[model samples]
Target chain A: MYKYDTYDQAMVDARVAEFRDQVHRRLDGSLPEDKFRPLRLMNGLYLQLHAYMLRVAVPYGTLSSAQMRVLGDIADKYDRGYGHFTTRQNIQYNWIKLEDAPDILADLAKVEMHAIQTSGNCIRNISSDQYAGAAADELVDPRPYAELLRQWSSFHPEFSYLPRKFKIAVIASATDRAAMRLHDIGIEIVKNDKGEIGAAFYVGGGMGRTPMIAPCINAFVPLDQLVTYSEACLRVYNRYGRRDNKYKARIKILVHELGKKEYTRQVEAEFAHLLTQGIEPPLAELERIKAQFADPAFESGLTDSVDRSDPDFALWVDRNTAAHRVPGYAIVTISLKPVGGIPGDASADQIRLMADLAKEYAFDELRVTHAQNIVLAHVKKADLHALWTRLDEAGLSTANLDTIGDIIACPGLDYCSLANARSIPVAQKISERFAGREGELGEIKLKISGCINACGHHHAGHIGILGVDRKGVENYQLLLGGSEGADTSLGQITGPGFDEDGIVGAIETATGVYLANKEGEERFLDTYRRIGMAPFKEAIYG
Target chain B: MVEAQIRFRDDEPVGDPAVTADSFGDQTNASAVRIEPGDDARALLPHLDRIRLVEVNFPGFGDGRGYSAARILREAGYAGELRAVGDVAVDQLNALRRCGFDAFAPEVPMNPADAERAFATWPDVYQPTTDGRAPIWKLRHG
Candidate 1:
């Protein structure tokens, strides 16, 4: 994990004081709500339905054990003793007081954390593959570049207010674990024929009322010009992107409207102009950042096997653990979605327990996955059983990763002011309905969002459900065949909308179709893609 | 009724009436131009020699296209008094200043002390824009 230097510390400290004054003005009524909304939102404070929601950025999903403990402490001190991890690898506390916001920010500053750029129309918290450093199949770690961009975009004078919110994702593997294509700007670190490492840029992808898979604007940019290229991409969008309508304001719409070639030409021109201005940070800065991500010490001559004596333990090992770069180690994903519970909510105790486990079992580190799960990235295979026991005792051990039970849902009508329906209940019912049978079902990414904002990432799920208001009652429209991985595709709606209970039943019926028609080892996504939406639609509709 | 202006340039801000981008080319004597949210700042490049002041209008602080407009003119070698006009908030002062905005005239007048504090908010910055200030990275690794 990256530690904050003096410069980094100073930046966050300044932001806290700045926001503190803003909050003061707002409370004193010097700044009206309409005027203060963007200022508050930039610091990740949102006025939810019942209360204020403060989103804290967990940059590139990386966290130290100490940082995790502080987050838990903040939840206990300022919020309602719980925090909801979001789809963007950030955490949100639903009950934040306006007066306490400055204090909360000051506390986060102590740990090199703050809510800066978590919301509002600015370059948001940069996301990357959760298993960046520890993954077995990565060309290089992507977090250093992510950090560099994090600095570059922090309080950026020009991009402070974009036409709309912008998102950027980075990945180093061919396997798109970070949903590279479905971002405003997606950078894939790739090697050329000559074996030189560079970045392939993808601009204009997002999933909202309009879902677009970003197109490749530049095939390969030199490693040193990464920031410059990104500046170019953003400059074009800021200059020409539509602002008349909020809905069509994302960079994706501009890219879609302008066509790829024209957009690329404009970016290249900007890149050329910026190159002369010396906008790119020196190579020294990136190297300094990369050194912080050096691999953790791995003990030599260790066993690679975990005892499968208990079927439950074996099931957990099969589902939650991923292969590590070092032998005899595993990347353990602690599932937050307990059956019949909120998708991403972890109590303060559970959060502290996970932090302790990271310090004890892993390498004093944890990561928040885009799927709203916590990962102990370097857990030794030998420590699996003991770790599992502790987590199980704490009710943190859920053996459902990417299964139907491991549903990703938003804080819907229960919390969000933008929500049209309640997503927590939908996720709970679906998770409960397929609790024991998920093993047979194989892999199914069930995602639900309460509204078209897609904060729940419904469009990227294997079985997506979007809640809408019909007249006055809540109705869910089911969609299928969506995947956020390398083969990224938006889920398509399957005919008519269903009532709350009917949607869950509809999902059951659709999965039944998959089971009956599935080949030997095809996942729900694979089966859905091969067979198309006909069978699922016929089953779901009828 | 609030005409308070904060100027950073050594030269006095020209008081000439500003013309729109469409009429800037037509008015041979026009020394100042006003850019709206949608107008391109590059349109004044050819007439930079005579142009003494450029005002970038930000009708709302949330619409940040003015920041880009200011930078484009500055980067294009327009060395005039770049005044950022309209709905400017105190919190936006540092960013506005860093984007090569040497002067400001908020539609709603700001507290001068707060404005000065906002100007000095960041001890350093992360990127080298048209502002001519060395970014923190350069200072660290120069």
Candidate 2:
């Protein structure tokens, strides 16, 4: 983790004080509601359907065990004893009070965490692959550049009030675990033919009412010019992006309307001008940030063997553990999705327990996956059994990672002010229906969002369910063939929408079709893409 | 008494003698000109030497085109007074100043005592902007 210096601490402290004053002004009737709304939103306070919601940024999805404990403390002290980890690798407290928001921010600032730019039409929290540093196939640990971007975008004057919200994702691995292509700006750190590390820029890709897979604007930008090039991209969008209609205000609309070649040309023009101005940070800054992400000391002679005598522990080890770059180490995922329970909701006690487990078994660092699960990225193989037992006791040891049971869902109409129908109940129902069929489903990604704003990333799910409102009734539309991996593609909606029960049955029928038609060892997405959505649609609608 | 209105030129409040866009062409002798949110700032870049103040109107705080306008003027070497007029608040003061707005003419006057604290809130910033403040990166490397 990047340690905050005196300057960084001072900036955050100032922001907290500024927000506290704004809150006081709003309360004293000195500031009217219309003006106070934007101020509160910029600080991550939202007027939800029930209470004020605060979304705190977990930068690049990395958190210290101490930071996780603080989150648990916040949930217990302020919220309703729980917090929902979102698809954006953030945590939202649903029962926040308007008056206590500044205090919450102050607490987060103490631990070098914040809720800045978590909302509003600014550069949002920069997200990256949760397995960034520990994964075996990573080209580079992307957290350093992510931290740099986080700093650059924070309180940016030019891009702060963009036409619409801007999200950026960075990933170094070939597999896009962070849904990089679905972001407004996606960066893949790659090595050029000359062995120099650079960035591949993807612009205008997003998921919302208008879903787009960002096209490559620049194949390779030198490491030195990454910030300059990104600034150029945003500058073009800030000036030319449509603001007449809120729905069409995202950068995707501008790219779509201007055509990729023209948009790229404009960005290049801006990049040239910015380069002349010498806006790129000095090389020493990059080295300074990189030093913070150095690998922790590892025990070299440890055995790589895990005792698989216990069948339950073996199942979990196979399902929830991933290969690590370091020998005799593994990345362990703590599944938040228990069968018949809400996805991504961790109780205060569960959070504290996970925090303690990270400190004990892992290297005191944790990651929050975009799938809304916690990851212990540097766990030793020998500690698997003990960790599994502790996790099982805490009800966090569900051997259902990437299975039908591990569903990705958004807080839909149940809690969201913009949702048209309920999503959590739908996700719960679907997970319950597929409880014992994890093996049969075979690596299915099922995502559910309550509305067109695809917060659950339903557009990237192998079997996507979107809840819609039709004449005062709840309905769901099924989509097939969406994948957020290296081979990114949006799911195509099947036929008509179904009632809540009908949708659950539809998912079952679709899974049955996959089981019957799949080739040997093929994942659900592979099968869907190979056979197309026709069979699944026929099985569901027929 | 006249209505309380906040106005500034070069971070200091001069009289509210800024001319609106509708009257800007006629007031050729005016040193400061106020442009609406929809007006293009590029048009005034060529006249940078004569104009000492460029006031950009923000009809609503959410309408952020003015921020871009201020940046454009500054990048084009308009070192004159860059004042953000209309719908401005203390929350937006730091950003406006960063985007090269040295003054503010908020639609509603802010309490001067509170506004001073807001402007000096973040003495150091992480990214370099038109405000010319040395970013933390520069300070660290140097």
Candidate 3:
């Protein structure tokens, strides 16, 4: 984790005082409701359907044990004992009081966390691969770059308020765990022929009212010019993005309307102007940020050792652990999407426990995966048994890693005012439908969003379900084959929308088709690829 | 005695900015700035200095044109009141404020007491915006 320097600390401190004053003014009636709304949103406060919701950014889903403890404290003291982790690796307390939010932010800042950019039309929390440093195929740790972007974009004088909320994601691994393709700006860290690290830049990819798979603008942006190039991208969007209609205001819509080539040309033209500003991030500063992500010293001579006799441990190891770049280590994913439970949700006590586990077994750091799970990266392979035992007690050890049970569903109409129906119950149904059939469920990513805003990112799921309201009844539309990794592709709509009861039946039927027709050990997506959507489409609608 | 003003409530217009959306329709002070989708923006750029209050209009609640306008106005050294007129709500007040609006006009009848409570509700904040400052955490601890 990057430790906050004096300047960073001072900046947060001053902002707190400023907000306190704003609150004072607002309470005093000097600052009217119309005047105070935007200010509160910039601070990550939202007046939701039932109560005020406060969204706290977990930058790139990285958390220190201390930070997690602080979050736990907030949940216990102020909220309803639990918090919902979001698809973007942020957390939202759905039932917050307007009066307690500033104090909550104060609590978060104490641990170097805050809710800045969790809402509002500003550059949101910069996200990256949750297994950034530990993933086997990673080129370079993407956190330093993510951190650099976080600093540069925070309250950037130029791009603070965009046409809509802008999101940037960075991934350094061969397999994209960060969902780079679905972000406003996606940067993939890759090495060139000369062995220099650089970024593969993708622009205008986002899942909102207008869903789009970002187009490649720059094949490779040199590491040193990352910030400058990024500025060019935003400047282009800021300059030309639609402001006439809010629905079409996203960069994706702009790219869609202008066509990718023209948008790229506009970006390059802005890149020329940005070059004159000397926007190149200082090399020393990069080094400083890089130093923050330095790998912890690993115990030498450790190898992959597991207690094969313990069925539970073996099952968890096979399902939950990923190969680490370092020998004798593994990247452990803590599944929050347990069957019948909310996706990306954890009680305050659970948060504290996971924080403790991160400190004990996996270096003193934890990561929130883009898949809405937590990762204790750099867990020793030899200590897998001990880790598993501890996790089992903490209820963090779920054997379902990416099976049907691991469904990604948003708060939907339950909490979000923007949602049209309930996504949680649908997810619960799907999970129940696949219960005890983990072996049969196979590897298929199912995502659900309640409305067109696509905060649930239904457009990017292997099996996507979007909830819509038809004649005052909740209905779901299913899409298939969307992937957000190195081989990114958009999911296509399968057929007509299904009512609530029909959705689970539809998923079961789709899965049944894959189970029967799929080649041996073929994932659902691979099966779809080999035989297109024709097979599954027949299975569901038939 | 009240002016035929267009007020923002919850980031939306109380009614249409103009009686109709076709034109600005001259008023005593034309705070209703026209946002040409692909306009060069050079005209708005220079005049930003002279404007004491910049009111960006949102045709609907979901229309986010004002967000960009706010950013551009703040960046171009417009230190004036950035008010979001039309389709405003109490829910969007915090976001508008963060984006640089210092005043608000909720669509509902103005209640001075309720307005005061709205701003004072959140005593601490995080994230930097057009207004620069550290959140309360850094102040008390760091």
- Give the DockQ (2 decimals) of all models: 0.89, 0.65, 0.09
Worst 10 residues of 3 chain B by lDDT: B14-23
Tens-digit lDDT track for model 1 on A102-164?
999999999899999999999999999999999999999989989999999999999989999
Best by DockQ: 1
Worst 10 residues of 1 chain A by lDDT: A533-542
User: For candidate 3, lDDT tens digit of each residue in A362-428?
Assistant: 8889888777888899899888889888878978888898888888888999988899999999999
Minimum summed lDDT over a 10-residue window in model 2 chain B is located at B1-10
Name the DockQ score for candidate 1: 0.89
TM-score of chain B of each: 0.94, 0.79, 0.60
**Candidate 1 regions off by >4 Å?**
B1-4
lDDT per residue for candidate 2 within A99-172, as digits (tens), equals 99999999999999999999989999999999989999999999999988988898888887789999999999
TM-score of chain B of 3: 0.60
- Candidate 1 is scored at a TM of 0.99
TM-score of chain A of 1: 0.99
The list of candidate 3 runs beyond 4 A from truth reads: B1-142
